[model samples]
Target: MTITLLGVVGSPSPGGRSFAAARALLDGAAAAGATADVLELADRPDPEAIQRAIEDADGIVFATPTYRARSSSLVKGVLENTGRGVAGDTRAPLLGKATAIVHTGATAHHFLAVDDLRDVLGGFFAAQVLSPGLYFEGADYVDADGIPTLTDRARELAEAHGRAFAEFTAAVRAAPAVRALRPLL
Candidate 1:
């Protein structure tokens, strides 16, 4: 079975750092024999369609740019639309699905925002989120034709994370029986 990885980017700009990172991650996933695509929230995509895409994907990468030591509002909005709060609804589409959280910030101070996302995906959605989520700061980028771009090291790391995410997602999909082990709440 072919694995499909979906990247949900929360950047407001199309070709900014967040988008570039997502593309690089997808590139690595493709190299690993998995198909990948990105869903940019800036385009004001339909919530229902986003949920459907999430359901179809084998794994997901939630990429965002940290704003004031937190995830962008765009990311928050999409997650809210895709899955309701655990106490309110049982719509946990991310259940048992592997996920990777990626974030870029003006400084390293906001790296913990990635952890916040990880908690929501794992604690609320029951997603198998990957550890040591990728974080890149403004300094990690260089001027490429007067545009911010990821350094070679950052790009390589994102690609490696993508490869790992693909392998992990494939493993999770293969072990459907493991879903039975989840809590019955």
Candidate 2:
């Protein structure tokens, strides 16, 4: 079956590390026979549209830049506006769907930002968040026309993660039990 993976980029900048990583992941997912696309919060997309995309997607990749040792305000704001409750009847649309969290930072000191996002997406929303979420440091970038972009290694890693996530999501979606689990909420 064809699965759809959506990348939600929370970077305020149009084409930063987070965006590049997300694009690479989506590219990998597409190569793996899944449909993929990225939506940017920097464009000020409508909340309802974002929610709809989340609900329609089989899996989601949340990409954000670390700010103040945590996810960007854009990411938090989207979560806050999207849904509420913790695995309750009114749980977020992400419940039971596969998810991966990707964050970029100036250094590795803020890696725990992934944990914070994981707690909310997995613990709160009850999504099947992929483990060992990705983190990109400044050193992982390379100079591209005087602008920083993801190094080949970082892009490869992100793409591999995306392929695995897409395959896992497809398997989860194919199982009747997994699909039923959502309605049990």
Candidate 3:
């Protein structure tokens, strides 16, 4: 069975490297036999829209670009919104869904952003998170040809994450307890 994935792009810049990273993961997921959709949060700042989208997916991949050593405010807002009650369903939809992260930053100085995200997600999301979130230095996305693509390292990581998430989501779907309940976004 195919699982639905929602990839939230948090770059806030049109067609930037962070956008490319999210696309690469979707490609990897597609190759792994899963269907995917990308939510370009940069284009839409509405947290309600983001929360609503997450409700329909089986897993989530958060893609962000580090700004001043942290996730952009837009991504932070979206993450915060996920914790709120929706549609008389007081439960956070993200509670049961698998989540992973991929991020890009200009320098090693910003590398801490990846772990910071992991900690934040882990604090609220816990083992639902995949281990060792993927990280790419911003320069890695650039090419002499000017068309951006994932680095070999990134491609490897994306494939692993894609495949694992597929399995993780399937297990979530098979749990007897939630069979009668709405999906955890």
Candidate 4:
């Protein structure tokens, strides 16, 4: 099955690290035979369009830069708005869908930002949260233009994560037995 992956970049800065990492992850997914699309939160997002994208996607990758030890407001806004639709339903629209997160910061101390995202995604939306969210620190991979360039190891990890998420999404969509057990609320 062809999996649709949505990469949401929440950084307010254009071409920031989080956005670049998201693109890299998407590229990896594309190489694995999955269809991937990008949505920039700073581009004046439309709630309807965001909802449509989320509903259509089989997997989602949320990427953001650490700001005050939390995710960017833009990213939070998009997720909060989307969560409203699935609030009380046993089977949320995002439930059973594979999801991953990526965060970037200037220091290793900012690793907690991923946990902040996890708390929101896992607590509110019921998304299948993947472990070990990719966290990049320092400027080793960042370019003068503020884009991220993954090293060989980083690329390998990103590709593995993408492939895993894609496979999980496919299996979840294909197995009726699994689907029957999923909580709809």
Candidate 5:
């Protein structure tokens, strides 16, 4: 079974840290034999396109740079709009699907941003939010090509997160309920 991993970059600045981190995660997923697609929010402003992508994806990886200790408006807009559709359904469109978050900031102080995203995504959308959200202290860890030069510990963390996401998606797809939902997708 093929798993679609969609990465949504929520940084307004072109080729910013958030975008780099999102690309790294996508590359990691792809290297692991998962099909991955990336949506740069700066390039795609239409909510319909984003919602369609979300609906079509098997798992979502949301990446954002900390803006005032919260997600960027672009990210929030995508979530708020798409989330509205799945609000009432116990089986949210994103429900039972794997979700991983990545956030970057100039300082380690912005770490709370990931927790905030996890809380909202878990409570509102019912996604299986993966733990240990990837946090980058600075953009230097990721080069211009979007390759992450992670330290041993960081690389291990990222790899573990990627594997967990892949495994969760595989398990979800194997479930009877998810199998029933596949026809509709």
Candidate 6:
């Protein structure tokens, strides 16, 4: 199955660490045979446009720069607005799609944001969130080349998540779609 992976980078400013991380992660997804694209939300985003992108994607890589102690408010707004739109349209727009979270923070403590996101995406969006979300603390700064080169460990983890996410999305695509939350027969 050919899968399209969409990376949405949510940074309050352009060229932030998380923006670069998202770009790097998209490269990893493309390397793993996914058709990858990205939407960097630095400008004023239209809610309808965000909803359309989320609806059309086969898989999503949600990357954000941590703010205070959480993912960027910009990212949260996108999710909240898109989630509300899709839920009203149908119970789950991402019923079988996969989503992976990547965050860049000031310290390892920022990694906690991934768990918060996983719950929101899985419980609210009905996304099959891939395991072992990625986080890079402080190291990756976007250079003049606009590349977000990750540390050895972070690079390995990002590539692994990409490969795993692609495989999982393909698997889910092949399976039958579930129409409702019926009890197991």
Best candidate according to lDDT: 2
Each candidate structure's TM-score, on Cα atoms with residue i matched to residue i, is 0.91, 0.90, 0.82, 0.85, 0.81, 0.84
lDDT of 1 by residue, 101-134 (tens): 8899888988898889988877767788989888
**RMSD (Å) per prediction:** 2.1, 2.5, 3.9, 2.8, 4.6, 3.5
Clashes of each: 0, 0, 1, 5, 0, 0
Tens-place lDDT per residue, model 5, 1-185, is 77889888898876777776777677667767688888989886587778778888888999888888888888898876764233264334565566789988888888889999998776666666778688877634645356445545555666567767777766766775743332122
Per-residue accuracy of model 4 over 25-77 as CA lDDT, tens digit each: 78777878889999988787787788788888988899998888888888888
Candidate 5 global CA lDDT score: 0.74
Report the C-alpha lDDT of model 2 over 43-150, residue by residue, as the tens digit. 999998999999999999999999988899999998887664434446467867888999999999999999999988866666778889999999999989966678
User: Clashing pairs in model 4?
Assistant: 89-185, 90-184, 90-185, 91-184, 91-185
Judge candidate 4 against the unseen true structure and give its global Cα lDDT, from 0 to 1: 0.76
Clash total of candidate 5: 0
lDDT of each: 0.84, 0.85, 0.74, 0.76, 0.74, 0.73
Order of quality (TM-score): 1, 2, 4, 6, 3, 5
Question: Candidate 2 — which residues are off by over 4 angstroms?
Answer: 84-91, 179-185
| Consecutive 10-residue window with the lowest summed lDDT within model 4 | 83-92
Cα lDDT tens digits for candidate 3, 74-172: 789887666633456474767556677888887667777888887776565432667677778865665637766777887677777778777776776
List candidate 5 stretches off by more than 4 Å. 84-92, 139-160, 176-185
Candidate 6 lands at a TM-score of: 0.84
Clashing pairs in 6: none
* Deviation from native of the Cα of residue 142 in model 2, angstroms: 1.1
Better of 2 and 6 by TM-score: 2
